[model samples]
Target: MAQLQTAVSMIYPPRCTTCGDLVESDFGLCGPCWRETAFLGGAICDACGVPLTSGGKDGVFHCDTCMQDPPPWVQGRAAVIYRGNGRKLVLALKHGDRQELARPAGVWMANMVRNLVSKDTLVVPVPLHWSRLLRRRYNQSALLGAEVAKNLGVSFCPDALLRRVRTPSLEGLSHEARMVALEKAITPHPKRGHRLDGKPILLVDDVMTSGATLKACTNACFDAGSGPVRILTLARAVKEA
Candidate 1:
């Protein structure tokens, strides 16, 4: 296996996932791409995982948006802010059919949410409607979630949540409108829903914008008796002030 891998590497050297530049490792960004990416660090909100200006007095923190409209999940985290190379990586994985990006993205998410994991934690991905799934040929969130579960050594329920309604594109919609469009659009899967009962759930996604989708997924888990749900995403879209 090692010899075959070496032969393959020699034949086709590994390149950066973002830029086409060669990198020493596989499934990663080049140095320039790495530095340009807005990987989240320092203080962040407990509810939405948006970067905060400062840490909280008591170790728990939430951004103003989260404070005003709290999310359904108990905690949240993100690997990067949605901009520059971070956004590029998310879009590549989500729409460019770059499925290999899931490995590194999932590892990043697992590391970000490491403190939240437990023996009974079940990793789940936000679902796509059947129509979208058929059109896209894959649910990017599920790939990320599966990798996260593998890295974390936890159980994964890819179908724990089902999208009952296919809503239109959420772009250009106000947060309120997005919420209305997603209301009850997601629910616990009848057959797989039982796996979520009383288990701590780690909800995974590629990007979090208005968070309406993640909120709906969290509520579905709650409806199925899921315990203390937490969310993790590859990137979080930060709104301009």
Candidate 2:
């Protein structure tokens, strides 16, 4: 058995999923690729997780956008920005064959939202429409949420929320337009709403581009009686002005 295992390992050696560098484990980036990924840190927004780099002292700070127009979710956290190596990793997971990255990405998200996770909390993924799911094979958000939920020792409710309506792609759309497109697009599953009631829902997603999608999902959770919906994402794009 040992000899056969060694032969198989030699036949299919693990490589870094991002840059294809030789690494000790699969689904990782080489040192340079890993360093290039911008892992967000510092005094972040209490609402949106935008880093507050202005001259204010180190403490809880909300970005100007979030301050002016807070999102529906109680708070938000992200592992990185949607640029550079961060974007590469995200694309690899979503488009490229890097489903293996979900483990590390989910672990990072779990640590970032550690403060908000509780015993009664439920990790809920923003759903993909049936058509999208069929094409993508699996929802990246659901994969990440399930991984994080395992680490948190809480329930992972992949179907707690459903994307009942399918709309055109939201890329390059204005914030208002995106919101309009997602109007009533997400809803808590009729039978699953009871499971969500009174539970602190940690909404998970792959990215927050403009935040309209997350906002819509948050409304669904709240409308179904979930308590204090907080958000976690692998990456986030600062809402366009």
User: CA lDDT, every prediction?
Assistant: 0.91, 0.85
Residue 129 miss distance in model 1 (angstroms)? 0.5
What would the per-residue lDDT of candidate 2 be over residues 1-241, giving only the tens digit for each residue? 9899778768887787677878776566688877888888877787778766663445667888887898888888999878888888889889986788899898888989887778889999999999999998999999999999988888989999889998899999999999999999999888776778888999999998788899998999888888788999999776434
**Model 1 agreement with the true structure over 65-167: per-residue lDDT tens digits:** 8888888889999999999898888888989999999998988889998877897899999999999999999999999999999999999989999999999
Model 2, runs deviating above 4 Å: 1-11, 55-58, 239-241
The root-mean-square deviation over C-alpha atoms between each candidate and the true structure, in angstroms, is 1.1, 2.3
TM-score of each: 0.97, 0.91
Instruction: State the weakest 10-residue window (summed lDDT) of model 2.
Output: 51-60
Clash pairs, model 1 backbone: none
In model 1, the worst 10-residue window by lDDT is 53-62
- Best model per lDDT: 1
Candidate 2 structure lDDT: 0.85
Per-candidate count of clashing residue pairs (backbone under 3 Å): 0, 0
